[model samples]
Target: MRYWLLILPKLPANAMAIFPFILLKKASQQKDVVLINHEKIHLQQQLELLILPFYVLYLLNYFINLVIYKNHYKAYFNISFEREAYSFEGDLNYLTKRKLYHWAKFFVKSSGDRLG
Candidate 1:
């Protein structure tokens, strides 16, 4: 999958966790590259989930976890999809030849469904 990275003017302090868009802030050139890779992983995920549904599911899951866990950061970190993106984002060659279904391995079957 191909992904696009967008940069914005202002971002919240916790933007990395719940950015809600493609913008990344407070990053050096190298860090920006890594962050772009991270967001690219998310873009792949969004595509897998069919765009709008992905964001809907993402927000629902996150809010549910936030209500239960009472910690936004913890909730964000615990998201399996996010975990997969973060885990591999730093790999310089991740986007070069990544497989289409790689992210599916990270899904929690009971809580989430897979798409092709």
Candidate 2:
């Protein structure tokens, strides 16, 4: 899949991966390899799920995590997708070695089951 980057100063997060696009909070973030890799991991996850279902599952996971954690930050961090991305974001070669449905392995039942 083709990927594109856009700089949006008002983005709530440092970066976000929306299928073919990776939205960044600032232009300098484009040089942050770890940040870009994190978003790329999300892109692969979105592509694997065919986009729409990715968002649906992502939101559903967040809400379920919210109910379990009662904190937005905790909920967001515990998401299967986020877990996978954050865990491997520092590995520049992770994408080349990643397998299909790899994010599924990060799915957790509770905060105790978090990847890292």
Candidate 3:
């Protein structure tokens, strides 16, 4: 699970955790463990999805959510994968304790469930 991190000031997002790599908007942000944890969660997810499909589904879901929410930020935040990562990135040991397909739960929200 070794990954290379590249810092690009013009990166579209704050950071991206693509499989085998992480792209950051600033080199200084590398020291943020919480951010790293968030990306690592994405790595785990990419592996679970066998790499390629993760990106495809990510884009598809983002577009769909974008249409549903009609806002870029809302679409990104409401993504189930983002939901799971943001919900647990602060817990460094989350991956060890996480169950297979645990992220699926975020996608199956109840009527009361909504992103903040």
Candidate 4:
């Protein structure tokens, strides 16, 4: 997928994928392959969902996870998109082999089966 990397010093996270743009907190992060791969996974998810709905579902998932986990960090990590990304970020070839809507597996997993 085609993507642009932009450095935004004030971004809350080290990096975030916003469709065609991958926003980074620092320019140096561009060299971080694992981080870039993680955001790339998000980019694929956004593309598959057609952007807006991806954000809506992402927020909804975060809120639901917030209620379940009662912590911002835990909620963020538990988000289906985040879970999918984190699970395979280290595998640089993941995107090439990923199936559409793979995040759904993470979303539908039983709470007891979730990763910590």
Candidate 5:
């Protein structure tokens, strides 16, 4: 992952994946494996989508959810990619067992809660 640690971003998230890169809100969080694992999940998804399409789809989903929930935080939390990443971020070896396009399953179920 192409890491870029800085201050705050436009979004409310502490870290965000931009395909090959991960933009972190704080440089100190670099050693936080759980957070890195979370972003890594996003990297896998971005890779599967070949980058550009991933961002397009992500924005589409976020906008759709934003309309549905009428809440930015709720919309972001419900995004399929975020849902999938948040689900397995805690499992450091999740990348090994994860199936290709695993985020697809999230569209069928409500992936609970938000994680940093």
Candidate 6:
């Protein structure tokens, strides 16, 4: 499916440091490309998990990891979906007909089940 990205102007300072972020104002070509790819990865994940549940699972996993890890960066990095996205986002060709469940392998396992 085709997705369009919208850029917003002036994201919160905290968000700015990590994500290039989508702004309402015009964005530079490079920023637009990166943000689009990143958000597209999120969209693909959302679709795979049936939309609503993906977000619910995301929040729950994040909090659980935060409490267990006691480190925000580690918590975020440990997220299964984010792990996959970060691992492959730089490969501009990742989104083209990528296989489902390819990312699930990157999820960090806690015991038998994977985290996030």
Q: Quick one: best lDDT, which candidate?
A: 4
Ten-residue region with minimum lDDT total, candidate 1: 107-116
Whole-model alpha-carbon lDDT for candidate 1: 0.63
Per lDDT, what order, best first?
4, 2, 3, 5, 1, 6
- For residues 6-116, could you state the per-residue lDDT of candidate 6 as single tens digits? 445554421121122323344463365554565567678877777777778777877987987788887887777777777676777788867886656765455245343
For candidate 2, the 10 contiguous residues with the lowest summed lDDT are 107-116
What ranking emerges by TM-score with the best candidate at the front? 4, 2, 3, 5, 6, 1
lDDT of 5 by residue, 38-90 (tens): 99899999899998989899999999888878888888888899889888999
The alpha-carbon RMSD values of the candidates against the true structure, listed in the order shown, are 5.7, 1.6, 1.5, 0.8, 3.7, 5.0
Residue pairs with clashing backbones, model 2: none
Clashes of each: 0, 0, 0, 0, 0, 7
43 Cα displacement, candidate 2 (Å): 0.4
Report the lDDT tens digits of candidate 1 across residue range 60-82. 76786677567888677656667
Which candidate do you rate higher for TM-score, 3 or 6? 3
Best by TM-score: 4
Of candidates 6 and 4, the better by lDDT: 4
Cα lDDT tens digits for candidate 3, 39-65:
989999999989998888788878978
* TM-score (all chains, Cα) for each model: 0.67, 0.93, 0.91, 0.97, 0.83, 0.71
lDDT value, candidate 5, whole model:
0.82
Model 4 CA deviation exceeding 4 Å by range: none
lDDT per residue (tens digit) for residues 1-116 in model 4 = 89999999999888999989999999999999999999999999999999999999999999998889888998899999999999999999999899999999999998887655
Q: Model 4 — which ten-residue stretch has the worst lDDT?
A: 107-116
Clash pairs, candidate 6, are 7-23, 7-24, 8-22, 8-23, 8-24, 9-23, 9-24
Stretches > 4 Å off in candidate 3: 110-112
The candidate, 3 or 4, that scores higher on lDDT is 4
lDDT of each: 0.63, 0.90, 0.86, 0.94, 0.82, 0.62
On residues 75-102, what C-alpha lDDT tens digit does candidate 2 reach at each position? 8998999989999999999999999999
